[model samples]
Target chain A: MTGPARVPPAAPAASTAPAASTASTAADVDGDVGLHHLRLYVAGQTPKSLAAIANLKKVCEEHLAGRYDIEVIDLMENPKLAAGDQILAIPTLVRRLPAPLKRIIGDLSNTERVLVGLDIRAKAAAP
Target chain B: MPIKPAPFRPSLPKTPTGVAGFDEITMGGLPTGRPSLVCGATGSGKTLFAATFLVNGAVKYGEPGVFMSFEERAEDLAANVASLGYDLEALVAEGRLGIDHVHIARNEIEETGEYDLEGLFVRLGFAVDQIGAKRVVLDTLESLFSSLSDEAVLRAELRRLFSWIKARGLTAIITGEQGEGRFTRHGLEEYVSDCVVLLDNRVQDQVTTRRLRVVKYRGSAHGTNEYPFLINDHGISVLPVTGASLSYSVSDEVMSSGVGGIDAMLGKGGFFRGSSVLLSGLAGTGKTTFAATFADAACTRGERCLFFVFEESAEQICRNARSVGLDLQRHVESGLLRFEAARPSLYGLEMHLARIHRDLDAFRPAVVVVDPISAFRGPDLEVYAALLRMVDLLKSRRITGLFTSLRGDGGLQDAEDQGLSSLMDSWIKLQTVEANGEMNRTLYIIKSRGMSHSNQVREYVMSGTGIGLIEPYIGPGGVLTGSARITQVAREEAMQLHRRQKAERRQQALERRRAALERQIAEMRASLETEEEEAAGWLREEELRELVLKQDREVLASRRSAAE
Candidate 1:
């Protein structure tokens, strides 16, 4: 298990502030190949939201250190964005760059499940 | 501190659904600011019911609503309800309605560990605030159970979601799939304890009927009977058989029964206004003729009449009535007469009742006719129940109902009409009396309450002009009709003519006899007069001769005396 060193547990507020801009810019520069684009949706700085952000960063750092980008969206501020992604559960991780979009709900505490959900281990095993 | 009796809470507040007869059944509508569970089997119209509730709230009650569907897309939902005449797209465009489709694909969804439905709350909150909605619909929330793997978390979140909806004070309808025995598959009824409605679409003997029942209504008095509802071009209309009460106000006014002879027979000039009249007869006994005549009379009086024909089309009825000199086509063209024709087998008894209820509401006619109600095929008791409700509905509105029933060839006590007769205020029976090798139509009032009706049977005559009742002709052999009546009348006329001729001949004979007797007496008198003249002449002669003799004797005496 990788420790959540890349994202502090209390950094959801600071990370979600630039989430909208980061999501737009990342979609703008999507010509790069083999990049893992992830978006995490949350409501405010709840423990579940912060843990999901920290755990998702830690997992990305261990599995896809320099190839992944994480964008944290706080639905409390941008509630209208929830409907566009068909969001129903908080702390949902949406894999944006994948050809087939995928959603993993709940706090990303289990590193193995997150890796499998994002199809990272399969790519690593095949490559 | 003595607990001050909880402020004596009144009845639970409700939000009217605006569905026809549904508010009456629920005494208002679903509990206000509370979640209601609408559970039914697949194709049982669960989504339609939810959509109707939301749409009616937005359009009718002026309360904006939000519809969050889990099974169908927003555009698909709008298209599906468009047939019901709900312009959901327009409502949404006007900001009176908000539709959000929550697409949850189990294949694309991956469950990691723990999650809360705060995203759903946020979305609902946003939609509600956008429209200031007072009503919300979470259609088929049970889909979440199939999409997510964690039952415990889903259940907890569902409970919280209901509370959140309540906290917002929005009347919400959450639909669920029917379970094996419970109200819903996921037991959503346990969460929506304020109101639970169950819709059922059942097929019996190849006929499908939709029924709605209020399984449980907390703190409200709702109709306990299963109400048959209809989904037509309008929307859901629940037909509550027990919704009408017996305390409808009655009118003392009288209206014509269309046939003047029949009116004369009914002493009051016609049937009492708003009274139920049953015209029962065997087949070909002119039941439709009487019904059409009554409808014509109502239309002639400028009152609207609605005719429901189960066996014949409207044009056929009009054509048949034209043969009897009833100009019903004119009334139809004038818009005072309307006919609703359908085969009795097209719908079940309750469905027929619901359709009738809908028509009555739409037309609001002053007179209604159900021609040959016996065409309805069902258990006799079920038919009776439906008819009872129909009569109640008509009477409650004070609309005159004329129901024609076809009876069997049995005697006066027709088995099918036994239960219906008591329900009718007046019952006119038509019988076909076979006498003198001819079939004669006869009509009589079996029972006419509150009026002295003629008990004598009159021969029902249908001529080119119109229907008339030939007064009862009680000949030597009882009531004569048809050729027997004509023959009896002819016989009576011939006997009177012969009696007059014989009396005239006897008077002539007596006059001749008297004349002859007078002539004979005159002849006798003439002879006597002649004899008397002769005798007088003789006497005069004798007297002359005597006088002459006396004169001679006197002259002799005088000469003697002179000589002396």
Candidate 2:
């Protein structure tokens, strides 16, 4: 049974401008390309959670350009969402788009690990 | 530069494991509100220890427990513990325990995306909440590594898992497989855990011993040496090598030694009640018989006695004693005397002590007799330490104990060298004295601490009527026994016979002299009678010649005399 209700993220990421530019460029190039559906689960507005959100936006903008969408699921408000994603550690990012799903645990600060874990690019050498 | 010590904090509140000796060794139990790692090699009783902890917590300590097995199923775990007298299903049904089997077959599921162990956490949380459990056991926690492809994630998640339990304030024992030079396979759990307990199964001389050592415990003191643990129907228990403290209550009362005449030599009574007596003797020196006498005395007094025979079977002991008129069967039939006979080599000293303790707990006997205690074959120190602990345990209970040891050719001195004599409150030595081409059994009281006892060696006879101790057979030359004693007694009796014969000869001579004297007197009397007759005849003839002249005078005289 799903325990507790779903709630929206407490705040939106400040790096939305870069993600919008990247998404528009990618959308203009590939007509009706599928959008990346991403969910970031965090316990609260802790530093680790905020850092995860910022890092995910940065990664999406740089890698997926404008063809990605991010959903921040705060476990503090909707802990039952953790059960849906099988989240045990906090600041976990799950990719729910482009067929097979992928999960990256811990803060998304390690760009190489986050990209490699999500299988975005084989050995995505950090620039 | 001098290294600065870490700030020490008070020890964490412990959640008692309830498994025997764990509390005592760990100083209070497992580190509470945190994950403690129990790592061991294969067949080292890791799972059993964890299960016993959970079961004992639920049943013994009145605290509910949740057992989440990553390897075995709930039914399998339950069935396994059923042999240990733990009814897991019943406890589960009664809401005292929750056993959740987390199955992770490599082929069943695919790890396609990012996943945490939220499912396991939820189920564990549900189980704990269901029973209001204060303790949780994750058997073989390393099994989760097989299902995951991400090592870094698994390591981080495990760390998080440990801290998560700490945050929830629930004590947990996470079991793992041991690796070379590492307590666990991953070697990372110990770093995250608050404590690490290592269980080892070692085999030497075809004898397997399971030992437990507390490798690390944060903010607490723990036993450093490896302690042998035992698993049986009664459950798992660890044997602490050191015995109880010497400062214990002592019973002043005395009890009989049970041998025919041994009690008189043990002092006013025999050994003190609650005292431990060691009987060291060579082969065929009546050690078992002496032990039987102790048992008999207790049984006759209506006090329960427990006889632990290591070499002989109960039937054999009973039959052998009956031949010596010990009559142990009647005590057995009456239910006052109990015999537990087994080969001590069948198990380690810990298991033997565990079984003895179990029986003692059930029987509550006033006296315990361990016949041939040295039968616990092992290192001399091991056997001696085990015996010391046993004596300590019985002494603490204020129960009289009689322990017999098979002394070697070195005899009492050799047995005493093992430190057993010092541990005993009373010590008796029995030996075979070879004299006059015969072996005689003799016993002596070596020492009885705090009590006056006889120091003289007493020769004893073991017959159908049981053991009889006589004063040592001392003679003119030296101490003689057996046929030598018989010869001395016979020699003295012969000298007595010669003196009586001499007196009889003198009395016969006196009787002959008296007979002769009587015969002589009879002859003299007869001859005198004949002579008197002759004299009378002669006188008559003379009177006849004068009668012619005297006849008239005689007639006249006769007439005058008649008238007169």
Candidate 3:
């Protein structure tokens, strides 16, 4: 890739092989200009991973809905991909498009900690 | 060898690294289609070892390799390895080797997103495809740990990298710097790799020694001992110096000792062709001279001789040998003899042995002579065992060995005490005896296995032409020696003269007594004759008197008697 960060044999004229975070790649670049991209890492589709996904969706809808992108990654299919995000715990959520990378642990049950971690502004509370 | 090459392959095949002395320890070489970890402290020569392995693979085994360095650039590594005699530029130009220096500028990037090392894998795969590389080397795995902030990410990537390299069926070496508690800084790659080799640089008593040990080798038998390794222009050479067993075919052919006296002292008038000989002596004895004689004799027989002089220079030994009539210079000039002269303190014992082994391999000499190898005694070496390693190498090659050992006391028992006498096939001892206020050289054979050797201690004499043994001294005081022998001879002469004079005087006395007795007999015979004449005269006078006065009685009686 043209990006000097990539160590490739055939130099690409465009950025390639950059950190392929699932949320960053899936985020709608044109529409979500100011949108925050998020990634949730879990071992498998267990109760914890499913509960984490459901609670994160609920928080996104109640707070900054339609402005954020969330991508869930299962480590069982691709265990090696977890290392790129520094994931040591299962059911960990990472803010992929923020200025400073932030990590939250657990099943996202604590709404207050989750809001503080994701820097979410609640639409109902603000109106 | 793992299972005798059965129909079904039970394990991975070994690909020889071709580094000097390393393949022997690995049985054949590193496991093919597997990733091996090499970890050491800074300046422990890990990169050099890895580079040598790669270069040797390309040059010797015809297996092209890829070197992906994370720390130094391509030019710096190539230059460093080039100084060690590796033609990196040539190999790269020929497309047999690929050097990719991945510059990880830690300050240039901020981690705004997550990513896997798919880019690195792609580049490595391209390089592998470029040269059909069968081997790969990642010289600084620790740099990857520093470049990334997340341990989980780096560890996962490393595991993935090892598995990928294995999947590609290429042998790989990942080198890392040792950390305080972990085998490597990241501490997880060693678990992922199939084998782990640890390099250690230790300074004991101010002498630095590099040692290597294979911590783990999955499904392969390897030497687990801490082998002393030497790094130089020839790369890393590991000497398993103290291994209890080394199997080699032994030669029983006897070889001359060069000097007639020494040969006669040895069993079968010589030593086994490949056996090791130990010559131990005090200072001023004939150890060096005897060793020179052996070298000269070997050279004269048209066999190559490698003389490693730890005490003197080759020229000095040659010049000294001229006094003893050994023409070493001629053999040296004729190319039948080679000399590697250096002080024992010039290098650590490992380097010393490595140099000797390297030279021996290059020269392929039939006879190897180490003059006073005991000089290698220092803080960093177990000199006895180190000497045995040298001997073992020579024996394995079927090369004759002659080693000289210096003893503080002039006794062969010192050699035995040092345990060299037991290892050597023959042990000869030289002595400096202070006989008659002069130091004299005498030699004796302490032991010679499998043949009857001379037990008599022959006094070794150095002449202008050569060295030889003289008949032992004998005197009236038992074997006469030194000044006492001369004095005993003079006393014997004087006593012999006195005895001769006494015998002459007794003969003269007997002659005088015989002459006197003959004179006496002659005088008695003359007296008897004179008495007879007087008797006749008396008789005549008596007759006349008898005729006159006694005529009456004597004459009358004589006449009567006459008448009667």
Candidate 4:
């Protein structure tokens, strides 16, 4: 609004795409960093993906204090939200955060790293 | 000024540069994922710097790298850096890095043919893909220029290579030789590369200085000064001239040099940790003996010591110490001292640096000694560069480094060997000056970087016990070489033996000759007697004949003819 103000053209089809997926996954949401509203876009129930879900639950409880939600959306089951986040790879973590959403692409070995990347924890004091 | 607020976003993680003095100079390392061009004239250390970057990436930073050489063969490159302690072959086996050498033959190939350099691109891309390499080095891009005669195509290909490296988001190092009018081969890699580093190997007053300057590094700050660097077993280390002001207060501890007089020359005690000491002199001046004594002292202080004997074997060093009255055998036996013997040509300069670096890492020595550093000077500028690196590495670790140099005749008479003089924190000269009728052994401290040292040349004597510092002797002559004196003594002894043998041989010869002459005279006398008797007989016969002739001259003549 302040600078060049090059507003991106609205792609309305993407807005309606996530709403339909949310209805089917609504039963699983428990309000754990939007676990109720969360969608984990995974290709299949591969070991990498299972590890990611298990790791997410473990990290959320330890750090997020259960004030959030998570919705595991297997792309093999829905296969539609992949285009919504522009997901090119599998096992991506999408933050339906406090506002402007962010995505992390990897098999999260570093839980603290992933959490820090997702803005879950306070930014580390400048070392 | 008001305190500034911290950024809401987390700061990016920093990566470390794997070079020895380089990281310290830059205060960290080059900007991550940016290509840097290392340019220099022949033997100016461009390739060495690039290799150092790749090696440090793999070994130091725990990041795998790729080294593509279009000039030298991979085996030759490996052999060259083998002395620097970079076991690229082993690193390859461990799958931490990949080294591919592209030999561009000028004779067999035609440059006019349309070539795409796709093979090179594929090879580089494949290497990067295999290792997930964060660093890549192309050594001597100039060779490509000569191999491909099309200058316009070569220039375009070079630009493409640089762009491809950046597009891949890899930190690449492209090395080129500086031409007379060009900063790089293809004459333009410098403009495209994110950073440009120039290594200059120049002789100042007959002594060569290898200086590295960062010409330009885009979008990031860098040290723009020409830093002195050394190439040794450890590879290339740029000695940052910027950090001279970073000093630590000295401790008054009476550190011993192991030699009593040498230690006593210092008003209070001995050299401080990180203080370099130079022991320089001509041959037979007892520099090695002095170094051995220092190693012994460091060992006695309950500190680890590494003695690198370039001129003598470790066993010979132990034996020689006996004559000098300083026994280093006990330290070796106790495992307090580790002695490594090497001829400089045993490896390239970088290889030597690496060897020392690896040993230092293993032994973690508090004090290190390079006996007669001159022995390590190879027929290349790399030797001096390696020595500079060795000095930088030791100084950074706050370890005391002692170097003994066998000064040439001119080196001793002149100010100092320009190659070594500037790098020394403290230079001690052990010269055999001819005063009076004999040569005297004198030790003097020419320069001590951070401490006060003895200004006066101290006369010292070596014997079976140890070094004995003497008061300025007021004798008619000094006899230190023990060469002329020992020779003179040997000659007098030989003369005595010669005189005794000559007298005995003369007596024997005279007796034999006299006996032969007497025997000859006796034989001559015997012959004379026989001849005289014959003559007398003839005379008697003649008288008889005359008497008989009167009686029967005709009958005697007939009888004599018939008898005959």
- Note the Cα lDDT for every prediction shown: 0.87, 0.77, 0.76, 0.68
DockQ in order: 0.71, 0.08, 0.03, 0.02
lDDT of 3 by residue, A30-77 (tens): 332235567787766777778889888998788755666678777766
Candidate 3 lDDT over residue span B462-514, tens digit each: 78868878766655444544455557768888999999999999999999999
User: Alpha-carbon error at B75 in model 1, in Å?
Assistant: 0.8
RMSD values for the candidates in order, in angstroms, are 5.6, 9.9, 11.9, 26.1
Considering the two chains of model 3, state its CAPRI-style docking category.
Answer: incorrect
| Candidate 3 ranges with C-alpha deviation above 4 Å | A1-127, B1-10, B243-247, B379-381, B411-418, B475-478, B482-564
Model 1 lDDT tens row, B1-564? 111222334388888888877777787888899999999999999899999998988877889999999999999999999989999999999999999999898898888878999999999999999999999999889999999888899899999999999999999999999999998999998788999999999887777899999999999777899899999789999988776778899988999999999999987889888899999888888999999999999999999999999999999999999999889999999999999999998888899899999999899999999998889887888888899999999999999999999886547666668889888999999889998788999999998889999889899888777789887799778999999999899999999999999999999899999999999999999999999999999999998998898889988888998887
- Candidate 2 or 3, higher DockQ? 2
Residue pairs in steric clash, candidate 1? none
Q: What are the chain B TM-scores of all models?
A: 0.93, 0.84, 0.83, 0.56
Q: Mind giving the per-residue lDDT tens digits that candidate 4 earns over B288-387? A: 8888888988999889999998778999999998887767889988999999998766654554665676678769998999987888655546556667
Query: What's the CA error at residue B507 for candidate 4, in Å?
Result: 68
DockQ-based CAPRI category assigned to the predicted complex of candidate 4:
incorrect
Best by DockQ: 1
Residue A20, candidate 4: Cα error in Å is 64
How should the candidates be ordered by TM-score, best one leading? 1, 2, 3, 4
Instruction: Give a tens-digit lDDT track for model 2, residues B9-87.
Output: 3356777777777777776688778889998999999889998888888777788899988889889998988888889
